[model samples]
Target: MSVRATTVLTHVTASAPILLFIEENGACNTTYNQPPLLILERYEEEEHLNLVPLNRTKHPLCNYVLTNRWPIDQNWLYVDDEGLHTKSIDREDVSIAFMPVSQIQVELNLHCGSDLRMKRSLSTNGEQNWLGPYDYGANKWILTDSISYNARRTLVNLIVKDINDNSPIFVGLENEPIVVGYPESDIEGFVSPRFLVKVEATDADIGENAAIMYWSTDPRVVVSPNTGDVHVHNTATIEDNYRFTVNATDRRGSGNTGSIDVLVKLLSSEEIVVITVQNSFLDDEDQVLSALNAAVDYDIKMLCASVVTGNIEPTYKRQQSDDLGVSLRLFVYGIKSQEAIKVDRLTSDLSDSNIVTVNIASVLSLQDHLDKLQICPLPGRDTGLLVATIVLAGVVLIITLTVAVCFFLKRKKEHHYDQFSDRNSLASRNDSIKSSKSEILPKINLDELRKSEKKLQERLDAANGSSIAANDMLPVIIEEPSKMTDVAQTPKETLINISAPDPKAPIVIQSIDKLKDSGADSDDDDEFGEKNKVRRKSVVTFNENVEKIIHLEDGLDEESSEPDIEVYKF
Candidate 1:
């Protein structure tokens, strides 16, 4: 028979003892076999059969706080059962390791250090894995079991806090000791507040750390806290010069502050009196000052003086010429109001020979007058245009005059040529007249004349039947006079004489000496008679031929003892 025991054991420990007893109860009593048997049994507890409490093994997310720009590679927290435990395990049975989650894992892997460190700077409003209130789980440290090859991971949240590490620095103050002038008063003697300068500063920190405030210790100087604009107030007690410091502080406090120096100058108000004089009267500066002092009865302080010469308007007297005189300008100050009035009145008097004029000077007026008072005035657009117009007009006038002269010379030459042509024509006419006179009065031969006379006598004697002697029948020919005396010897009588035997032919007797006497008398009449004397001789010769023809036609037998008369008249 086999004895087998089946019993349920609860709350048993490993390596504990167990007892088994068998009893016979059907035939006889079997109490003698077993007096009490105890067996020693050892058992192993398997990991899968063990139960673990939920509270003992936990996966918790740990949070840690750090500042930006903290020490690198510094241990912030340890991944162990004591400080960063998430599982129930012995320190030697598990391996601790850390890995950054998300994009920060790449950053953590590059650094080989065991401890955690902020490799990069963090900000409140930054786009980094760790922020000012970093709530995202950025890292996970693992507790891996060495025996079971299981891992227990815990999340680590890194919070980056902002610190006030940067101080406020002044900006745009490179010209360190800033100089400002005091405000000038108006005609009512009331000075208005004016802006002096603006101060600026910058900070590197963010949030409340970057805000700045401005302040000044000087009573007269006021600064705007937000805008950093400086101004002056209550200027009645201002000094000639003031040197003070303007401070700039961040919102973090006095530890982060900056300062700069500023200078303020208070100048006394003054009036500028300009005195213009002719250089001929007061060219020297001392002379101008003396004359001004004498004219106004006050000692004048001349700040500056200048003299200009050449082609400038005379400051004293009016003149037409541009080169009037030298202009002397005197910049005078420290004159009383009454003296200024007196100077003005004297200048306006025109009788005052020294000073040209005296008037209040302004910045613009002084600059303008000084520009115009140059020794050589610059030619402006209008001046250039006037010069161009004058030159053009002069050129046009010269051209016109040249053309007129050329036309006149051409007309005069033509008129002279016409006069020469007329003289030539008149000379040609005179020559033609003289040539006709020579041709008309040809030389006669005496022998031919005698022969012709003898023939005519023979014919007349045959016709009349009267025997006439040769000497009596032939007509006489008178010689022409060669000299003026020969012409005067001729008598003033009938010019022609002829006697015929026939009653039908009237007897004609004319004296040739009378024609010569008439010609001689006409020659003594005027100056032109001398010129007509030659023409008269031509007429005398022509009449001689006419007498011969008459004697031949009428068979004249009677003849006068005087030479046959021949008359020539022009």
Candidate 2:
């Protein structure tokens, strides 16, 4: 229902002023037409009514009303057939209803109950017309009212306040607990400017809520509240691994806190002596270690050395005549400070020698330096074992080759000897065959035999002409080759063939004078005739007898045959 007010005046005059009354559905009311002044009241935003103001301005009428009358108590109003009324307005017969209106009208409509209670509604886009999260600043909100043919819109601004709701969280260190390595100070009881690690965290809140402060309870380390940088303290010991909790807290209200695990590794206080030596010294590990130990004036421990080859910084100086030389790097540890100085001095003195340079560095810095140079530490034990295995294998190979060569030489020698023996055996067999084909006997010297036979014949003739009787003399039988025959005769008149004398027959020789002086005589004429017949049988009898004597002188057997002639007959 709509309320309509009609102005009624009892007297109207320009100079006396016009008096007017308000009538609503025939109900009278007191009214005075002063100067037709329009009053606009300024109102602040009310939480319960959900009434927000876009632009509010102070007016003189609102101040005059507020200063003259007591504050209006908020009460529920109802509309009836008489008009819009309240209990206080019924008693005083004076009521003013202040209804908000919009400056711009649109096509949308907003419906409210008679009690002026607002309910959530959806727009044409099917989205609920509601407020979003509260953000600090002026927030714009559009309120629409729609009727059958027209709609009105009002613009309202909302200023949202802030509240501590979000907690600070780590930013970069999200996957695992942060692990950082820091070296302890080389000097005793001193703290170095070693940046351990940086921890970063962020908060989803704004203003004072996003301001994070870092803190740690670990005694060995300290965290920068503003920068989140963790630093090691002087009390931190070497070779220690420490774990601590770092908290990030915001600065709003009862601050929301976030915690993270951080691991800090404190390295040892050892120093490294980097020695660059010529490649010639790389073969003998003992010599290199000894020289290094002597130069440093300290005993080098085992497994504390690492060898590498590469282009290193601060190389050795070379002359024009020197060839390009490779460098071997030796990284030695376990030496104290005093020895490190000695090493430095020796390095300067031996700069032009096999030792190129020796540099002393802290463990951390040296590691960084090596990393930049891309030099890796060689494992001493593994390298040594590999070298030993290679050397042993080489030695075994050499021995095997030597043995193989010796065996080959021995086999070749044996083969040559067998060939020589076969050739010699074949030659000997040919000689034996030739010797058997032509049989040879002992040679008799014909000239010497004839000479001796002539001498013997002369002796026999002289003996026969001497006083030895025919019976006393042995008959010399000389048989012709044509007259040789086998004949049997009386023993007193034996016949002999003198052509072939028996080589084994014995002959007796005596002096012809001695035979004559013996005076032996023959009596029987038959014996004398038989001697004459035997002598006539052979012309070479004396020759054959002489040959028999020569055969005896030439070493023929004597006892094999009896005498062929009788020299002296008894």
Candidate 3:
């Protein structure tokens, strides 16, 4: 079947139906190599069959295929049910395409110099072709096609499917050596998710063909698929001299890729610490420093004792033999102090191990949580202060000595006063004895006592003569009226002669009934009034021994008369 016109009217109005269909045959004449098609019959149910296409035996064949390759040989033919049909060879800009079907499109124009081109095909769409891969001088198509109406004027956007035209290019991946983690913090765990390196690529191809994906062969590292950032997956879990390669693959059909070598190194975690300061306030002249310097190896001893013990307690204050001080030495270096931590001297047991070549850091300056290092003071920095302290201490010493001497003198004076008191007491005792010796005037008069004794004898003789009965004359008791009996008296009056009683005599002591009958007006004494009085023994010889005998003076009451003193024969 063949179409004679571009437009046709059909009686089908409810819906225009596309009635295109293909045909196949076993022995139809194989001529133009064209595909079979079925002849149109009934296309719609509602439309009248008024339109029809007749088999056009006479028609022009327009070129359909386009190619980028230059034509070499030609004997073009089309085969179909009629076997093979010979096609005309009209020279144009080679409108027909080549066999392999290249993606490159070409538009033809003129040649260089005066080489005139042959005006070939007059077809509206035909273009002129010359002798090169591309027509650099072919500027004749634009103005002619738009204004002159001679050349092909059409802009077709052809999408050439990717065919792996380019390999991936790793951007900046020219054998560059990348190191991870700061040298100071070489430990494996320190490298966080922070990007170590970024892998990138550029491809001349467009769209998915140019898109690059990153991949690594090393297990210790991984790369982001979209960002291409290389990262440490696990450093400690991998082996040493650990290295691998990374590939940048495009999304092309072949996955054409470019690669770069990656080197993984476990940077050394150890560092050598070199402590530099402005100066250390160590007493270089101290003998302990000199001796310790000799005893210890040169390398073990640091810049100064103070440098080691800067913020800590001064080494001079450290105990050589003090037990408590030894325990408290570390305490003296409390971390609260803002000064750098240090030690005075290393013990023999720990000298080798504790005072090791440990690293503060490998950086220019050790980072103390981000603060800068403080400079040390100069040696013997307190000389003037020490001198002033010494002067003040001397004044204090002098004052203390003066006070002590004054106290000693005062105590001596007190002791002298005590001695003077003892001497005065001794003098008083001597004077007392001298006064006793001089007191010989006022002697007791014995004549008055003798007269009183005579009177008493007369009264006793008179009373005995009147009251005695001849039969009972032996020391009989007499009861007489009280000398002035103006006062009331109970049981009359009792007079006792108070004569000495013979030790052999059986004496009848009368009871004191009269005293018991007396009223309370009589002077009375407390029951224990004499509790504190000391009792004494006294003896008096009545008429000095008749012969010339000596008698010892005894303690007696001065008021007692000799006659009133009664001596008991017992």
Instruction: Quote each prediction's TM-score.
Output: 0.23, 0.26, 0.25
Candidate 1 residue spans exceeding 4 A from truth: 1-159, 173-175, 183-193, 252-255, 266-570
Candidate number that wins on TM-score, 1 or 3 = 3
Backbone collision tally, model 2:
10
* 10 residues in a row with least lDDT, candidate 1: 101-110
- Model 1 TM-score (2 dp): 0.23
Q: What is candidate 3's lDDT per residue for 1-570, written digit by digit as tens?
A: 333423255543332223444456555543333222112222111222212111234212222222122232333322232222223322221332221221222222211123223222332234324323443223321211112211221111111233445777776465443322222233324212244456677765555667778787777678887787877665435444445677888883247888876544332322111222112233432332333344444322221122343232332222223222211111011011112223322332123322222111111212321243225434466677788899999999999999999999999999889877865688887998788878855565678767755755554444433332233322322222222223355444222343444433323221122333233333345586532222222221222112222222222334643322222332
Top lDDT prediction, candidate number: 1
Task: Estimate the lDDT of model 1.
Answer: 0.43
lDDT by residue (1-570, candidate 2, tens digit) is 332333245353322232344434454322211122111112222222212211113211111100001112323222222222222211111222111221111111222333122222223223212322323123122222221211122222212223456688896456446555444456323323335667888875555767899988888778898998877665765354567888899983249999888664443433434455444344655676666566544444222234455444444344223323454545444333212223343344334334323332121224444565456545786699899999999999999999999999999999889877855688887988788766765566777778867776655454434321233333333222212122332122122212222344433333221111111122223744632112222122222334332211111223444423333321
Residue-level lDDT of model 1, residues 199-269, one tens digit each, is 78887554576788899887878889889888766563555456788988887345488888876554222
**Model 3 spans > 4 angstroms off:** 1-148, 151-160, 176-193, 234-241, 252-254, 265-570
Angstrom error of the Cα, residue 81, model 2: value is 22
- Candidate 2 yields a Cα-based lDDT of 0.42
Candidate 3 is scored at a TM of 0.25
Where's the lowest-lDDT run of ten residues in candidate 3? 327-336
